[model samples]
Target chain A: MQPTGSVRPGGRTARTKAAVTEALVAELLEVGYAGTTIERIAQRAGVAKTTVYRRWGSLAQLVVDAFADTAGAQVPLPDTGSLEGDLRELGRASIAMLRMPHLRAVFDVVVREAIHDPAARSALTEFFAARIANGAAIVERAVARGEAAEGTDPAEVIRMVGAPYYARAYITGEPLDPALADRTAAVIALAAREGLLLR
Target chain B: MQPTGSVRPGGRTARTKAAVTEALVAELLEVGYAGTTIERIAQRAGVAKTTVYRRWGSLAQLVVDAFADTAGAQVPLPDTGSLEGDLRELGRASIAMLRMPHLRAVFDVVVREAIHDPAARSALTEFFAARIANGAAIVERAVARGEAAEGTDPAEVIRMVGAPYYARAYITGEPLDPALADRTAAVIALAAREGLLLR
Candidate 1:
């Protein structure tokens, strides 16, 4: 029976894809990526196994898609009328994302796999490179607004803001904290004021 | 059948334990911690399998000992008449050690294992905490000498100096270049001069 004014088959497919994606992420968080399987995803999503296979070629592809799918729209660069405000907001948002337990687990799996898999490594690197560039753009905007000095290395500047969190997260195995975020932002802002990178 | 100057059979056994420890580290580098085994170590070191069991009760214990055996003395804080000189030397030495692929492989195994094993994680944390304290002592000495400002958060200061190279190694999956080390040292020195952190 045809329902009147029903959307096209493409809409149904898109819904299915979204359901499968969410299910994959949920399963990943629950069971970990190593323990996740296509069949399990099918069971969780209530979708046919064949449908999952026909859409994504492999489990790695599915996991990668699931990761990329969860990335939020770039946190709007804080334009609170000042560069420091903007940067502080950016740092807070970035730290918040890194602190997410589910995402951190996914990051752990993907990065561990990346050590042995060239393709995964490339994908992860490109993903971060773009994110770093997006962050640099915020710093550049600040410089344009005269909040930051001219010719600041935006990538390096952004790196400085994120470095402590990543170091804590991956090295010391400590949770990134809001207090750290504030201190880092303060340090970077001071460095920016002095144009510390410049000779 | 002891040679002249051999104390006793027990002394020979101690020699075997030292040989086994050295062999374990070499094998860990060659095949990673996961692939290493007590029997393989005995074969490689030409020690009886019982010797390994008698000294280290488990693989984890053996690995902990091997790691302890291999770690050199902490890089001495250079008071080369200047804080910059001291930190730069420390940075250079750290870069040299971390850049060693064999050491990094062993480190990667330990870190991954630490994620799943509480005992390993505790041991690993203790190792790093001690290392951090050692580095902090150098900064403290610098402050005492008036080369650096007093009340500098030495741990945080060291983090700032060392974070970039490690971020590259663990996060970016990039090589730690000598040029990058030079620039990082320069930045840390500049920040020190500006009293970025209280001594």
Candidate 2:
């Protein structure tokens, strides 16, 4: 699908946008965000620089859109009619996403830029929010199944279970580990079953 | 305190280390990490450059040491008899730490280096790991008091709760909000008690 902000008549159309985005992703993975430019993106995509600027406003926007496009496809949350099964599936998928080298490079650049660039930060947040929202929907389904408390907050749970993996990837500069994901899922599952502790 | 790998030499005790560390921190805050050199650190500390270099081999090492030194004397965790209270205490203290502009500038540089430089990434990891470990210890105490689950991974929980705040601050170049910290603490507490939903 075409990005919301990237259409101008007689400019790069939906098809060219897709091709340009793919080209951008390849260049980003090869040269990183600092080296990947509109010129490079156009040459790689076999499109003109005018076509690129006509579609996306800046290199940053193109990078954000390309990253999102790469991460757009969502894995279906497992439905074994059990919360444990659901968590395991969700956790595993998250781990896999963090392990994608191309996406990880994009994520690294986005996060670094996010610290200083408002537009980049907004794009990163938007990307994360959408993914987490999808995970939350799956969790809400579990809550409705009576596997979890009615008061369960899927978004918060996503933060609880998935945040650590992201932290490890960014903070520690490590690929995601399935074992860690499993452990995190278990801990979150336990918390859902038992209420918060009190001294 | 002197870094773990450094050797203890003639006449310099804990107090001297503290003084030197303080000097280094001041310089780090005043000048960004890249700008803070061994010569500057020695001059600021009223010690010889050889002394500073003898202890820490590089500026990255010195910066890491300075960070550890500055973050050493945190407000002690409060025994509020509730998970929420304990977490709030940690959150407040953390926000206070992140608010120091000089420190924030250093942090921005360090995080950037972490993304691009292997040695810098290692130093940053070590720096972050200690803080995460300290936070876990506080959580563990709460767990022992039955204020949190015994199985609660304090390190993971800290990462989960800490991620968004840092993400926002890192990406937006903004200060952590006290209210957001409260919300994070509340969500973490809830997740600890009710368990998060995962489908």
Candidate 3:
């Protein structure tokens, strides 16, 4: 009844959390957000229903936590010594991550859920805001190095680099080939050089 | 048991279809894709359940048809003699359309449905492809007017013009203002003028 020797300290708790998060993602992919259930996730995770219930409280919370666990991993900012090179690297990484089948499936569900669920929407907004802040550093470095305009909007530069690829991938459902990353980086770099991105 | 004077020819059939489509869209916006039911749609439309079933057969079909009906309206291609003017018009139109509450709700449902349903995905793909094709004429006319390079990819140019706005509107959940549309048009026109969009 007590989850059998689950009284172990931090190590076991971390392991249980990881297992539950993994199961939640797998269940989400298999059954979609509408069909995913806390009971099913508990069974799949090999954890007690009460444990899951006590920890997450609801399926929505579990999903947001799972998404944060997976997507919240630190993406190393490129320090390639040039604004163009750094943006190219960032764009490549962003597109490649979105292209992954598992990540794509997760994004589809999370974005749809965010449409109607305020909590999910807030979580997603926070996730993207964090990413944008992280990427803004690249533009800041460029400005310091005299590689970009002094007044360039760092967040706008970052958004420009990833915008085209995300549009193709999510909005229009177009094929996202490697060339798109290159083009996106090139266009943003061109715009920044022309002082178009300056605030 | 036949209904009195209910046998008008094509006019009645057209009216019935119009009513059913309206009901389907309203239901989708009200309860979302998973919750929308043919029975409810029929009830709201004042049509018999058998009529709904006989016409649409399934929710997926009904949704796709409804989407096509709504989005299939002609979006007149811009021909302002200059690529910049034309692209600006197109971009503004696209942003305005997406900002509409009704169309936004329909897009939210269709895009989410497309993720898990093959029928919905194909329908969306086809719809977008047609739109891209229609918008491509702007580039063609620009080329004829000597405003763009001969090798400019029409579809690519159109995509570029719309990509940033779509990205802001949907992916990053950023605010879509008129200024964003102007900037999108300017960037794409600049890139195309530089022959970067040439195949």
DockQ, all models = 0.30, 0.22, 0.49
Question: How high is the CA lDDT of each candidate model?
Answer: 0.69, 0.67, 0.79
Best by lDDT: 3
Off by over 4 Å in 2: A1-12, A53-58, A71-75, A195-199, B1-88, B99-102, B133-199
Residue lDDT tens for model 1, B79-168 = 666667667777777678787866666666555555545666666666666667777876777777776666678877777777776677
Categorize the docking of model 2. incorrect
Which model, 2 or 3, shows the larger lDDT?
3
Interface RMSD computed for candidate 2 is what? 4.9
In model 1 chain B, the worst 10-residue window by lDDT is: B1-10
The candidate scoring highest on TM-score is 3
Clash number for candidate 1: 5
Q: Say which prediction, candidate 2 or candidate 3, comes out ahead on DockQ.
A: 3
Q: After superposition, how far is residue A173 of candidate 2 from its true place, in Å?
A: 3.8
Best by DockQ: 3
- lDDT, residue A144, model 1: 82
Ranking of all predicted structures according to lDDT, beginning with the best and ending with the worst: 3, 1, 2
Tens digits of per-residue lDDT, candidate 3, B15-38, equal: 887898888878877887668899
